[model samples]
Target: MTNHFPLTAKRSLELLGLIAIFGVLYIAKDIIMPVLMAFFISIMLLPIYRFLRKKKVPESLSIILPIILVALFIALIVWFFSNQIGILVKDFPQIKSNVSQHINNLSDWISRITHYNDKEQKAFIQGKSDDLMNMGTKLAGGAALTLSGVFVFIGLLPIYIYLMLFYKDILLRFIFMWFKTDHHPKVKDAIYETESIIKSYLIGLLIQITYMTILLGGILMIIGIKHALLIGVIFAILNLIPYVGALIGNIIGVLLTLTSSQELWPVITVLGVIALVQFLDNNILMPRIVGSKVKINALFAILGVFIGGSVAGVSGMFLALPIIAVLKIIFDRTEMFKQWGVLLGDERPAKSPMGFASFRKKKPVAVKSGTEKEE
Candidate 1:
């Protein structure tokens, strides 16, 4: 007779294991995040690396050249933003006047709704402003620490990417070594699929960012919104966060519009333009460019964003979808984790007998041996 494991005990162990994994992620996120980012970047650069190799470029130069190009592209973006920000600073007086006008308008609206006099409104706002000031002071110190960490993250990223690219064969060998010879083909397939997914996803994102920035910035500039390009840049970058990102981008766009302009029409126009652009992007651009290779469900995507944010803040949120996609790839290919892949996936299942009667499809009636039967 064979001894069987109890189902409840197995499930409890699984839950505990999951909790522990999350704990480890939260603890080592600072180190883990950069490495993970580098891994993705290296994968994205594989085509370039291989192309250079085919051209007889030296091994070290192949890796170094891609890194250099990527660095320069990033530097150009930084320079653009810095220049725009400098210009924005020069218009501070106008922005300040607009802000004061908006505040007074808000005060009047609040007075009408709540029957609060100007003095009471001013006092209430003053108290809130004091609290905000205190919070800002705390955030300033935190920002300095965050800024230092960012520098370190940037410094280590290229080194990590270079090493990963350099040791690509060793990594492949190690992965192969983990599995039996018979399973080597499947492992190879999974690796290839994973690389394809990462390459398509990241490259598609780059394309999306460029177009989104141009479309949003150009439209906003046409509408006479101040600092149009800056808003576009912020939105395009933030929009990488899936469903939540687009919403946040819209909020930021509106806030920027409100701060820059004295008129309410620009804010409304910003919203309308963003909505139209988002509609086009979601309905048309995403399907064509990104494809349905990683069809993550809305529920899981939102949950992943929130969970990632809790675990490692903005970086985690940004990395969450691709990580899930990679995990789904592995899970779908592995016997033990296929159920998890199904759970994470966006595939809709056929209605079951256990489902609501209204949702279940009617069975066709058939005659078998002169007897009516449901088929």
Candidate 2:
């Protein structure tokens, strides 16, 4: 026989309180995202801060130098890309003409294959042509909006970064102080794990991005792709979104190649290069760097990316994996959260092979047979 008890009123109230908290967070997401971004960026740069301090750099200078360098690097990229974009804008009429030609060619090909009349094909393509033009306009507008936001975020970022760096110690202490005395060990362990995960993830990501940029840029240039630098930079930036990013980059490259040149070889070359880079990233770079650091499975990673994209757009997608990693770290360190941690991690909770071996050795089993009476 089994007995069961209903949840007490206090337990029900606690569950409702949690739901209320989540509802509030959902509503206040916009305000929260910027602050969360600041915190993550600060965490990523903390190692540089420590390195500078170790070299006897002043606290203020240590904090300021990394932030300044990062800001300048971002500024240079923006400036270079802005000039390239200006050229593209100036050549927009030619691009549109090229696109229209491509569309016509595609329609003609479709007509031949399907045995449709030229007039019907033309009518169908006209609708598609309008859609393409509208989409191009929207993309350009979105890019402008994104760039404007970047500048604003950059201008405000240093202040938040500095504050985090300056008060890092106080912040840690404050967080730990929330727990009771008996829980200090657990809290400290959680903090340590969180730091390890964040540091590993950020550094690994930066290295991977740089590697991809150089590899992709060289390949594009070798394939005689126009605006190779721009394409490379775009791919590298988008590649931060994990699984879907490389696919998007490849699609964009193929479309651009197809539109600009009628040469099938160039398009094939572009596709090949992207595939090779993706292979290398997945087999070599990602496994050695990111995989070791973040133990999240592909399913959770994809879910995180989608949820993050919904909440915070591309920036949210970039933040998603690290956020999940941090949460996994915290959950792993908490007794009540072990199940969540196990769900988040890729590894099974089964005992290690060595442990089983040792246990077997310690408690060896006796074999019995009809002819083994001497034993």
Best by TM-score: 1
Each model's lDDT comes to 0.88, 0.78
Q: Please, what are the lDDT tens digits per residue for candidate 1 over residues 1-65?
A: 13455656766887898899899999999999999999999999999999999999999999999
Which portions of model 1 miss their true places by more than 4 Å?
Answer: 1-9, 353-375
Model 1 alpha-carbon miss at residue 345, Å: 0.5
Best by lDDT: 1
- Please give, for residues 13-82, the per-residue lDDT of candidate 2 as tens digits: 7568757855664687666676778888898888889899999999999999998888887888879889
Worst 10 residues of 1 by lDDT: 361-370
TM-score of 1: 0.92
**Model 2: which ten-residue window has the lowest total lDDT?**
359-368
Cα-based TM-score, every candidate: 0.92, 0.83
Find the number of clashing residue pairs for candidate 2.
0
